[model samples]
Target: MSAPNSLKDVYLDEMKDLWSANDQMTRAVKQLGEKVSDPKLKQMLEHSVGGIEKHTGVLKQLIEAAGGQAEPEHCKGMEGLVTEALKHGIKEASSDGKLQDVAIIAQYQRMSHYGLAGFGSAAAYAKVLGMSDAETKLKQAVSEIYKGDEYASKLAEAVEQAAA
Candidate 1:
């Protein structure tokens, strides 16, 4: 994508970037799901895949509404985050089930925090653009991401206790 010449351009770019980010995260979460042993964690990851797909659809719609192509721009930031997540959560994971679950939670939260920032920024841009519908959808995605992050934290605590 070209350099943003206006706030509208920036908004469109952000949506495109998030579209890519959600796609990457969806794949990573699925891969991680296969590696996890905990039933709750597995379920959370499965749900996340669906949520990410839903957010991606909203992003595509927002991009089109902003008069931009619905194609996703490659999100290098998310690429790096996904790389790190896989490396730490799966590649170097502990053999112990509880410890591995903790590592997975840490990686998952890192990616989720990244999503929160991106979605929140896009929502702000949408608000400034007077695109109330886009803003609402983005805000909803952010809220869902927050809920997942919170659940991951709780799961991490439980896994840690089990490890102890």
Candidate 2:
């Protein structure tokens, strides 16, 4: 659906969508942490989860500041990603610690890329809707996520080569 007619409506809708994405990250990261056998992989997933929580709080505050509600809308998109992550983490994960590390890294990198795209779009929409502050926040988050994706790719590749 399109954004709301008013600024407040736009803020609330964006807030709900962002919150939903963050919540999904929380759940998915937990599952990633649990299923992956490597300690390093688990630590990375845990760290990402913390970041997601921080982003969620920021979105919530922005929504409230804009006179909009700050609750999630049960983001089906992220839900699907999380579900797939769990399934892959379970079935595709290797008994070899290094292989599992590579797999987990791949999963998280993909998710980070998705986050970058999502937040980038949201931030652009927020800017167009005249929520410059929210746009800045989201765009910054997107930049971080893009960096994270690059980092994860390198990490995963290193682990994969080591495992080879």
Highest lDDT, which number?
1
lDDT (10s digit) by residue, model 2, range 85-106:
7666656777887777676676
User: What lDDT is reached at residue 105 by model 2?
Assistant: 73
TM-scores of all predicted structures: 0.98, 0.85
Q: What is the TM-score of candidate 2?
A: 0.85
Please give me the total number of clashing residue pairs in predicted model 1.
Answer: 0
C-alpha RMSD for every candidate: 0.8, 2.4
lDDT of 2: 0.74
lDDT of 2 at 95: 80
In the range 65-149, model 1's lDDT, one tens digit per residue, is: 7889989999999999999999988999999988888888888888888889999999999999899998999999999999989
Model 1, position 130: C-alpha lDDT score: 94
- Candidate 1 has its poorest 10 consecutive residues by lDDT at 97-106
